[model samples]
Target: MATNDKQPVDPVVRARRQRIRRKRARQSVVFGVLIAAMALAALGAVAIYNGAVSMPFARGFSSTVIPADDPIVPACLVEGKEKPIGYKKVRVRVYNASERRGLAATTAKSLEERGFTILATGNVKTGVQNAKIAYGAKGVGRAYTLAAQIPGVVLQYDARTNAQIDLTVGQGFDGLIPEDEVKLETGVPMNNLPGCQPLAELTPAPAPASAAPTEDATASS
Candidate 1:
């Protein structure tokens, strides 16, 4: 008789309770998935930081296309070191080894006005007395050309294989000497200096030319 007194539960209330339970279950599932994704991301970042993994986007390109140690093609040395090369043909980089600021830039400007190609300008670590012209074995003539412009410039032969010249100005450096002071020969080949390397030795051997096509081969083509 006491159990019969309890009323039956409403169908509408039961359906509403079921819907709330389903919504809570879906929310919990979504939260768990988010936490798992965040944990994986954190692990990936740690791996990259420890150098255990490399990212493709982190690598960068090299500054230069050719390696510095690779051999370079020699310039035209038809006259060798004895004869002077034209100022326009000389490629130079001006470096200031003195305490004076902007010396390299000013010197480079002056050389540019004299028809010399200024490649770069910077400061050097070692100091010099007057100035030094550094050139490679194949750049002796080019160095001579630049030496004519700078007074009391010493020529230094290095291990480089190209024709580019480096002009390092020192504490005692002044502007280029007077044009009349430069001693150079315009035409006529001069005798090579004692113990000087010949052009044949300095220049690399030319590659053999390919055979020309025959008349019959051309006609067929």
Candidate 2:
């Protein structure tokens, strides 16, 4: 395998070998670059998962998909199960049972401001002792929401009323329930569409006035 001059290694053969080496070097560089890029991508993803960036999770709103195993998920993100509904969607008629001539009109205006759709306002056929919300079979949940925003208003399910709901002002009527005090229940109940857990679920019967606690009594207690 050894020659005196080695035949000068053949010009064409030497050129081919040089080309092969250069090709191999280029391939190696490309492979290395690909590997580095993959590593950087993985690191960036890890950083995001570790709280390096802000997330969109917020209160009273839905969020993007979240991994069940993720520890940073917020408690507010739980499935609301509560359908999206607006107060204007609920139809109601306010009646003045308090013997106040313009009480019905005033109450109607207030309810309208709160997004309730008042079909009509008038005096009650039979004067009520306490403000009450009467609803037909179709709008119990909507009715309950309205009643919640108005303290001391008891809910009564009546199938006869053709409209969605009715509000009757009574002799003991005080005023609209404070927005902060009213807690809207958000969740799908077991009842059918126009049905809801009986009014008792949200509003318990009010304690008799005689048994009411005065500020002085409460302070003493």
- The lDDT for every candidate, in the order shown, is 0.67, 0.59
On TM-score, the leading prediction is 1
TM-score of each: 0.49, 0.46
For 8-62, candidate 2 gives per-residue lDDT tens digits of 6888999999999999999999999999999998887787699795445535454
- Candidate 1 lDDT over 1-221, as tens digits, reads 44677787899998999999999999999999999999998998999899998876774575423211213233334454356777788998777776777777788888898789988777766546678776776676787678767766666556666778788787678789877776666763434433445444554333213212112221221
Inter-residue clash pairs, candidate 1: none
The local lDDT score (0 to 100) that residue 52 gets in candidate 2 is 91
RMSD of every prediction:
17.3, 18.2
Clashes, model 1: 0
Candidate 2 colliding pairs: none
Report the C-alpha displacement of residue 186, candidate 2, in angstroms: 6.9
